[model samples]
Target: MKYPIMIRVKQKQIAQLVSLGKRLDGRGLNDYRGIQLEVGVVGRAEGSARVRLGKTEVLVGTKIELGEPFPDVPNQGVLTVNAELVPLASPTFEPGPPREDAIELARVVDRGVRESKAIALEELCVEPGKKVFIVFVDVYVLNHDGNLIDASALAALAALLNTKMFNYEVKEGKIEVKPGYKPLSVKNYPIAVTFAQIDDKLVVDPWLEEEQVMDARITITTDKDGKICALQKGGYGYFTTQQVLEAAKIAKEKAEELRKLVVKG
Candidate 1:
């Protein structure tokens, strides 16, 4: 499908400028747009957060419940992530089951958190191989200006950081609720940075316009230790080995910057 003439013109203009380390939004090639974050947004949720990256916005809520652990990971708790692209968020989105983009978004976020071992699942187990706590991370897109993955990932992490565990006691395989609550054990902080390849140059936190003109996009996720935990590539374009390595280095630095914003000491 061909983009309308105006869109093509915009694409060409954006791409030309990006080749010169410039962006239509006045950001440098490696600069991210403004970010705003708020935690504990949902009173009824175990944890919740809202993150706005440029014009893009995402909300994440976490719910915890007692459930059986997976057979293979019987000793550890479960972590599941789901994403919804609300119709009001974008004209392109419609109300229905999760589309491919929504599924991909959830998977990317899940990989980052799971690979980094951000949540101390082992500590959530009530009984070995019998019962455990299940953490559900639900990501909702409230606006779609681009960089949804980064915003969603940040919100998920922030929500998890704000998560509180219910106090309970196990007696004869039965759980008894207690009056007090405790903070969830989060062992690591993982941050995701997404880059778009436009005019052969990679730009950080591409806005909606930049994303439409990009060749490929790749997301790099790093843990609290500055070690890479996950990587996902999308679009039809491919990055060279050197490009990937360079992106990794930049991603490490960017992750640290983003982590500080979402994680408090």
Candidate 2:
């Protein structure tokens, strides 16, 4: 949600271009920037993925640990997500407690995966409620250009998909690791698409500049089945009914593209 002064000027120019049915980056209104994904980039983490959406970059790491399941979901495993906006990534981000923006980013990414039931928690249950495998997904912002939500979600999904859990045995209430590995029990693939409304023009995958001038933002999550799993809207700007419908259509299209990329790896 941070914007620079140069970005503000670019927004004005983008707005002018939007009025002419064009974008400053030469993309159509619903066009998305190029995406580059790399998996297993971090040697230390169990699983890791780095995503670059134009100038924006995000890294996600997945770690697995043995733990007890929640009381209500005794048969299901747990998945936790955390995000950090590193100071080194952006001058505006400070080294301290997480800000509200960071919290929101984590929650948004979590919702997309959790709500979609992408990971089959029941499959992670080792010994009912007594023992289970917990997957911890951490997202680190390496650079802030725009659309952190989408980039973070993509990174998280890719990381989880590539994660592997070690073989273990529960003996007399003590869990012990064996010498084997299994891919994480992932059920569905979820992808998030974000749209920003700039000067009454709804644009998909807003650059940093367009995000600064946009009135409101909308994010839609879709599963591999092409069903909407979650939706989140923020900012003070309002969108017309037609714009909302159009945005949904655009989201579905982008989701398909992202789904293919995630599955390819």
Which candidate achieves the best lDDT against the true structure? 1
TM-score list, all predictions: 0.97, 0.95
Error of 2 at 45 (Å): 1.0
**Residue 238 miss distance in model 1 (angstroms):** 1.2
RMSD each, Å: 1.2, 1.7
Q: Tell me the tens digit of each residue's lDDT in model 1 across 164-233.
A: 9999888887889999789898889999999999977899999988887788999999999999999999
* Highest TM-score against the true fold, candidate: 1
Worst 10 residues of 2 by lDDT: 1-10
Error of 1 at 18 (Å): 0.6
Error of 2 at 62 (Å): 0.3
